[model samples]
Target: MISQNTISQVFETARVEEVIGDFVQLKKAGSNFKGLSPFSDERTPSFMVSPVKQIWKDFSTGKGGNAVTFLMEHEHFTYPEAIKYLAKKYNIEVEETQRTDEEKARADERESLYLVSEFANTYFQNVLHKTDQGKAIGLSYFKERGFTEDTIKKFQLGYALDEWQAFTDEALKKGYNIEFLEKTGLTIVKENKRFDRFKGRVMFPIHSMSGRILGFGGRILGNDKKAAKYLNSPESDIYHKSKVLYGLYFAKQTIAKQDNCYLVEGYTDVIQFYQTGIKNVVSSSGTALTPEQIRLINRLTNNITVLFDGDEAGIRASLRGIDLILEQGMNVKVCMFPDGEDPDSFAKSNTLTDLSDYLTEHAKDFIQFKASLLARESKNDPIKKAETIRDIVNSISKIPDQIKREVYIQECSKIMDISEEVLFSTLAQIHKKDYQDANKKYRQEQKAFEVVKNEEYAKPKVDVQYELERKIIEILMLYGDRTEQFEDLVLKEDEVSGDLIMEPTIQKARVFEKIYLDLQEDEMMFSNEKFRELYYSIIDKLNQEEEFSTRDFINQLDQDAASTITGILMEDEKYGIDDWERYQILPKKKTDTLDQLVSQTVLSLRCFLIENKVEELKNNILKDNVDTKTIMEDVKDYNDLKSLLSKKLGKVIGSYVTK
Candidate 1:
């Protein structure tokens, strides 16, 4: 377990914007930072990070929390893992106590897998550097590829011995569990006999964005026609091939800094580019580019330059990735090298300046690259040319931004000697078809959801009191620590008879204290359990701590309560500053109007409770045998009180007459 002091130190040292900015590209927006939602697919940014509060909110998906929660949600890190990550990022020392053997045995499956993967990575690196056979095979192969020792070490490149049981035996001898080793796909077990999966191959460790080893890609040195030349770890709990990008850990910072990512095909391609001073490059790792992978790149920047070999296969791969990038509302460019030269070869042979110049001079926008490539193939054939135009239009239709789509359409029209009008018409038809198909799929999914819901109990409906309770909770979260002078009604016990009586009093206290005491005096409670729990917790913290920290408060709550409070606090920030003015709506700033806002919210809740009582009184009057006169008197008194409260809120009360 991580020491509390270390966790607190991490929380204090880590800035929400800086910690999140490592994984996201953030642009300044007034007092906060805004970026595209890393949790969802979004064109315009809806993710907001407030450095003052040390929290972030994704308005698009409604996920928000402090720095640790953001990591837990975005990167799927356990609480300890998130703390450790922050500690490393901020250079804070993490002091942990050793776990007992029983505790270690009871550790969760995912953490065990992570430990196994880390051990395997270290073991492979040791083998490549320390063992004679590894140096002879793995080290020599990397050296032959012109990879420097520093580059090899930076990427954690390593080699596995030729013997099948070399790695598995060593790992088991180290007392690492067999279950995790097999689960991580580091060891293959057949009929109770286990051997290494990547035997006789050089290892390339694939890392998560946070630099944890998720899996490995191994390249077989000796050619065996029957065996696959390149092998990747099978899918596991922590590693999904489609979602893992080669060299993302190394390239993420550079990618965000440069505002562009260079997409290549293999692990060596990424390494070569990084070694040649082009650090912002990643690979699809020989898999077909996936939407998940595209979204990963989109998080850092919306600009991708796909580096391709001059071979036909490379051209085909570039074409395949272009549409996916465009669909994600990203700008894509293509750079193809000379014939028979891949990124790995090209980067090795050329100087940094030469390679940089070649890329700049040769890189072409996707539309132009596609048009030129297809136009060359369709020379003197009108049918083929018409087909190529349609193909280009199809690519253009996938673009989400209308302005970008129009720009591409015009470019294609000019390049193909076609009219812009004709191209626009084609795009419109394609969009219409796509819209119809999407609607159809949505309806089918909705119907399926309805059927499943019918088989389960329906969720309880929320009452009006729920919103009122939520508003109160929101007030406590936003302004609980501020001192306020409150006129409150308290109950006093008579000394002689011990009877409780109401006493009107005024006190200067924290807003949280005033609200809590006021609620207690009224004998009122929040209708929602979550809101009630959060309210009490906030009050308890305010009473105990000298100064309240919103970030610290959020950390102490469970995920659900933390998320709920975040949604409420960040609700007003959803609207951009210009949006209100543009729409002719002038909302008062909460900081400037806190006193009025708090009083009004409290009055609103009281009025809602009074309205409920008034309705109950009327229901009693409708009963056949009830005391109508007494009920009428009670109703009149409550109505008078409600009217006075409504007047205090700057609103006139409507008549309560019933037909």
Candidate 2:
């Protein structure tokens, strides 16, 4: 457990932009930084970071919070992991509080797997450098591939010794659990027998975007007919190969800088290109490209230049992957190396300048590349040529942007020497087919929707009570400790006339106090559980602290509450700004209307509650036999109170009152 002082220090020192910028590529948007959401695949920027408030909100997904919560959401870090990461980032000396046994036992399984992988990463690196067999075999293989000692260390390349139980035995000796090792695919354990899975292989550690080791891809050094050439860690809780891009941790910053990524097919290709100073390169780890992996790169850039090997057959088979990239709305370009050269071989043989020059000269847009490759193969065959044109048309249709699809259709028309009318007709046909197919999927899901649609209790309705409670909470969070003047609506008797009247009295109180007094006088409790809990929490904090900080308060909250608070603040900020101000059409400021805002909001809530009470009292006659006379009088009294409240509420709503 981290000490309170340390947590406070971390929250105070660590900058949100500085922390989140490590993962997201943020650009200045007026006072805030805006970027494409890492949480969703939106072309426009919806992720906003307010450095002033020390919080961020992804409008695309509605996930908002302080920096700590950002880490928890984006990196899947445990609360402690996020804190420790920040403490490390800001160079804070974390002070520990001793944990009880039960607390220690509560640490989750995924984090344990992460620790095990981290340990394996360190252990393998040690073997590659420190041990005789590792140095001779693993180091030798990497060197032969033209990788330097610095390159080897940069990629965290390592070697696994040939002995069957070498890794498993050493891991167990160090008290690392065999269960984790087996799960991470570092060891094979069955029938009480254990052996190293990557034995006699050179290791390439696959990392998450944040530089944590998720798993390893090991290449067998020996050409044994019985053994596979490359072995990847099996799917586990931490590592999913289809979603994990090799070398993304190192490539992301450069990709963001260059505004393009060079895609390859293996670990060595990424490392080799990176070693050659082409740093914005990543591999799919030989897995077919997935939408998840494409979105990962999409965070940094919308452009991808896929580097293909010189094999025509492989290129033809991989054409579908190009459509996947296009479907993501990514600008796709293809660069094919010369015969007999892969990215690894090409980079190894050429100087940085030569390799860079070759890439610039050879890269072609996917439409042109696909058309040229497919068309050249069917140049003399009219039937195959027509089929090639349709194949290229299909690729163009995968592009999500309608405008881009049109432009590409024009390009495809010129390339295939076909009519624009024909191409547009074909596009319409493709879209129609796509819609039908999607509608079929929708029909299949209609049964699921049918089962779901009837549960009115499951569906949240328009809730005025909950909204009012939430508004009170939002107002408190935003202006809790600020002092303000309020017109307290006082009920009094007109003794001379023998009638009742309402009087307004001036009083000074903090914003939170004004809200608290109103609710307490009404004997009201928030109907929403979350808002009710938060209402008390906010009041207690405001009462105790002389100086209030929203960021600090949020940092101390549980994730759900923190997210809710941040969401409210962000949503308010979004609407609070009047965009027409850009046209010199200034709107009223929130602070200028604070008094009226508070009075009207509270009055509105009271009126709503009174109306409900009146309804309930009126409905009592519909119930079992009761005293009709007493119920009628009670209803009349409530109605009189409701009427008085409505008058005051109407005055507040109609115009601001200076009391």
Candidate 3:
């Protein structure tokens, strides 16, 4: 466990823009930096980083938080991982509290796998440098591939020795459990024997976006006719190949900055391009491109230019990935090398300037590439050409942006020498079919969801006190520590006569104290359990401390409570871009309206509670023949109290009764 002092130090030292800029490209927007959201696909920037507040908000997805939270969200890192990441970025030493054996044993399975993967990565790298066999084979292979020593180390390239039990033996000797070894797919356990999985292959450690080793991609150097050329770590708790793109950890910042990503097909392809000065590139590691992968790229940039070898297979590969990119609302272009040249070979053969020039000169938009490629096959055959047109239209329909679709339609019509009318008509039919299919899926999902929801828990009916209770909690979070003058109507008992007299009193107190006293005087309690708990917790903390730290308060909460409070605090940022003052529509600041806001909120809550009491009394009056007169009197008294509260709020009694 990291010490609280260390965590606080890390939080204070880490600047939001500096930390996030490592992963995102942020351009100056007024006092804050704005960029495309890392959580969603959008061309116009909706993501803002506030250096002054030390926080960031993505309006597109409604995710906002401090630096640590950003890492947790964008990198899917655990709290500890995010803290460590920030600590490293800011050069702060993390101080740890020693954990007992039992506490260490209680660590989760996923974390164990991560630890094992990290250990294996270090072990492989040690072997590659320390062992003569690794140096001769793995190092030789990487060097022969034209990868510099720095590049090799940067990518953490390694070698697993040919001996079957070499890695398994070392890992077990180091106290790593065999179960975890097998779980991470580093050790293959048979009936009575255990052996290394990537034996004799040059190791390429694949990392998560946060730079944790999730898996490995190993290339076999020795030519064996029957053996596969490359072997990747099998899917495990920590590694999901479909959700990860190779070199993303290294390429994310550049991809965001360049406003484009270069897509390739293999690990070496990515390495070669990166080594040759193309930093904004990633590879599918030979798997067919998935929507998940495209969405990952979409988070960084809206544009992708796929680099393929000048061969039939490479062209087919580019064609396969284009629609997936289009479906995610990204701009895609295709660039093919000279005859028989892949990204790896071409990059090696040409200078950086030459390769860059070639890519710039040859990259074609998806529409043009599709038309030209399909046109060759459908030469002079009207029916084949018509089928090709539909194929193109199908791709166009996958585009999410209507404006982009129309532009592509215009381009496709011009390229294919086909009428825009026919294409639009085909597109309309396709859209109708898609809508029907989507509606059918939605209905099925809705039915399944309804069945589960009904069985587990019924939907909550709205309580009138909900909003007021939430508002109180919000005020306590936002202004609980601030001292303010409060006016109250209190009934005081005369010391000698023992008679109570009502009077107005004024006192200065902390906002939280005033709210607590006001609610206590009326014997009011929160209706929501979560909010109720948070309210008490806030009061307790305020009583103990002179000031409240919103971030600290949020950190002490569980995920649900923390999320709720964060949402409430960040709700105001929704209008951040509106700049109402610029249009002479200046709105009252919360500080200026604090007194009215608090009074109105409290009054509304009292009225709601009284209204509930009156309703209950009216219900009782209608229910029984014996107590109708008594219930009617109780209802009238409650209504009178409600009217008094409304009058105090300066509202006409009968006119505001419906509220």
TM-score of 1: 0.89
lDDT digits (tens) for residues 212-243 of candidate 2: 88999989978798998999999999998888
- Give me the runs in candidate 1 sitting further than 4 Å from their true place: 436-463, 484-510, 577-587, 617-637, 651-659
- Point out the higher-scoring one by lDDT: 1 or 2: 2
lDDT, residue 156, candidate 3: 92
Q: Which is superior by TM-score, 2 or 3?
A: 2
- Per-residue CA lDDT of model 3 for 273-347, tens digit only, reads 999999999999988888778877876788999987867756765686799888877899988777878999999
What lDDT does each candidate get? 0.86, 0.87, 0.83
**Clash totals in order:** 0, 0, 0
lDDT of each residue in 1-659, candidate 1, tens digit only: 89999998998889988989888998876677788899987878899888887888998888998988998998888889999999998899999998888977777999989999999999999999999998988999999999999999999999989898988899899999899999999999899999999989999999998899999999999979887899999999999999989999899999999999999999999999899999999999999899999999988999999988888755765687789888898999998889989999999999999999999999999999999999989998999999999999999998888898999999998999999999999989998999999999999988776555552357666577888788888888778889876544445898888996545466687888767765664477777888888888888888898788888888777887888888888777777523555476776676665655666677778778888889999998878988999999999998977776666555211111110
What TM-score, to 2 decimals, does candidate 2 have?
Answer: 0.91
Strongest candidate by TM-score: 2
Clashes of 3: 0
The lDDT-based order of candidates, best leading, equals 2, 1, 3
Error of 3 at 565 (Å): 1.1
lDDT of 2 at 107: 80
Candidate topping lDDT: 2
